[model samples]
Target: MNKQKLLIILAFFSIYFVWGSTYLFNKIAVSELPPLFLAAIRFSMAGILILVIAKLLKKSIKITRQQFLNSTIAGFLFLVYGNGVFVWALKYVDTGFAALLASTQPLFVLFLLRLIDGKKMQKKSIIGVGLGLLGMYLLVSQKTIATSEGMVLGIFMMLSCVLSWSYGSVFVSKADLPKNFLVSTGYQMFISSVLLIFCSLAFKEDISTIKTISYKVQMAVVFLILFGSIVAFTAFNYLLKVVSPEKVSTSAYVNPVVALFLGWYFLDEKLTNQSIIATFVLLTGVYFITSRKRIAKQKVRPSQKT
Candidate 1:
């Protein structure tokens, strides 16, 4: 029991902190490499590393045809469209604010769950979802999204990303994916890398120019491949199997604060007083929903006592 609890906490921490920091790293990487090319290379390297590690450990890397198809679908939804568009939009939007916008994911996931699999939501979840939407409104108004000429397009693209990722999150749970988490993630990344590279070619991003990329950006790519792709994403898949999707998705709430602080500290991005207040509201909403999960235990206890 203790070991299981420890694993859960570790997984939560990996997604919470590592994914949050990725915004800053991704922002840095996109500076020197085009977004699709950057993502393509990052996923390809990470995929190769994961496959190699699985092989060295003598783990079976084989999957059924259904599993391969499922993994590829998830790869397109989560990485190709979701992350790729978000990275492309980072050229115009601030990383902190982009994360804030992405935080709307859980709300989208709620409805998708309802629609896709008939998953019922509790009352507390409804209240939390409403609160999250309000925070999103306040967050966007306080930032460039309200008035910047180009922000409309960026925001639209980000909303599409939220939709894509949310659908992928829900669908992955139903798909017949590989049971070996590392092997599954490796396949997913490899599939996405292929599509992203094709996209880079279609867009005419000069792949040869990557040789001229700065050492700092290259280091950021390495960091993303290791921690962001391998550690955090694998932890996320594990959590999806063991926890409620709503609880697993709560990383959306914590991630914005981390990204916002890191952006302010490292990139010198502005964090207005209003944005801080909105952050509190956002996290409080997440608390209402995630915290309410405990009522299940209390209800179960009464029945057992009788």
Candidate 2:
């Protein structure tokens, strides 16, 4: 196939494999690192690395006030809230369940997009949303979700996190961002890291505790920074340029599968029949939504008299 097709494939693999594994990493990392502090460090380090690279490349690091504001908002929602609560929730839930809940982001995005843009709902997307919701219910039903008051609070926090992420995604699409996507991403990560770090300090996380953490957990943190932040984020931006946004977004559907497998393999997490069925339903829905446009285009033929 063409180079564009190859890049799309590479992007899919990057997000599917790297992000899928990130759930496991987050679960492990939180065991040693405080949630907000871990996020702060990861994004801060990645941002600085990317910022240095941008300077070396002579790319304009200057951004407008609007761009900075947008980035901060996006960072707060997607990073501080989205990923922050995710890391926190991982403390209370298993890797599998966390992945399942996080994967519901697309459904929220679909509805939010319609509301923000006053766009009509596509039939396929509607079906996809339904299926996704069903999958979420099945996935959660299989697990004996924690009933403690703290766990209940954590669940609500995670749900709020997902909504914030979805909202931020829509905002990003509309925002006047920097021409260099990588540079823009670096700025966002940097801003998010700073914010999270202040929050971490406010909570009084013990930095000394980090030194006592296991080697495996430290390695997981490094992997999350390198693979999830740098490699996967760069790959995703490249894929957006090479392929349709819709196609690139399919990673959302594939990531949960990878997360589930990794959880099972590494954490020895149970995969119930309910989860299996939910996976089938979710995949089927995603396939239909992603293919719907092409399928409709194919239906129009020269031979048909209109």
Each model's lDDT comes to 0.78, 0.74
For model 1, how does the per-residue alpha-carbon lDDT over 1-306 read when each residue is reduced to its tens digit?
A: 698899999999988888898989999988888999988988899999998988898889999999999999988988899888788888777877788777766667667767876867788888978888777777777545568777778878888888888788767767898877788878988999999999999999978869898899988998899998888877876787698765676676788878888999999998788787777776666666555663333211000000
Inter-residue clash pairs, candidate 1:
none
Most TM-score-accurate candidate? 2
lDDT of 2 by residue, 1-306 (tens): 997778777777887788778889998899888999999989999899888888899998999999999889978887887887678777876676666666666667667757876757678877887787777667655434544445555666777787888787777767787878778889989999999988888888876778798999889989988888888888876766576656665666677778788889998887878778978776666555555563222111000000
* lDDT (Cα, 0-100) at 39 in candidate 1: 89
Residue 4 in model 2: lDDT = 72
What lDDT score is found at residue 13 in candidate 2? 86
Residue 267 miss distance in model 2 (angstroms): 0.9
Model 1 TM-score?
0.86
Clashes of each: 0, 0
Off by over 4 Å in 2: 1-9, 146-152, 289-306
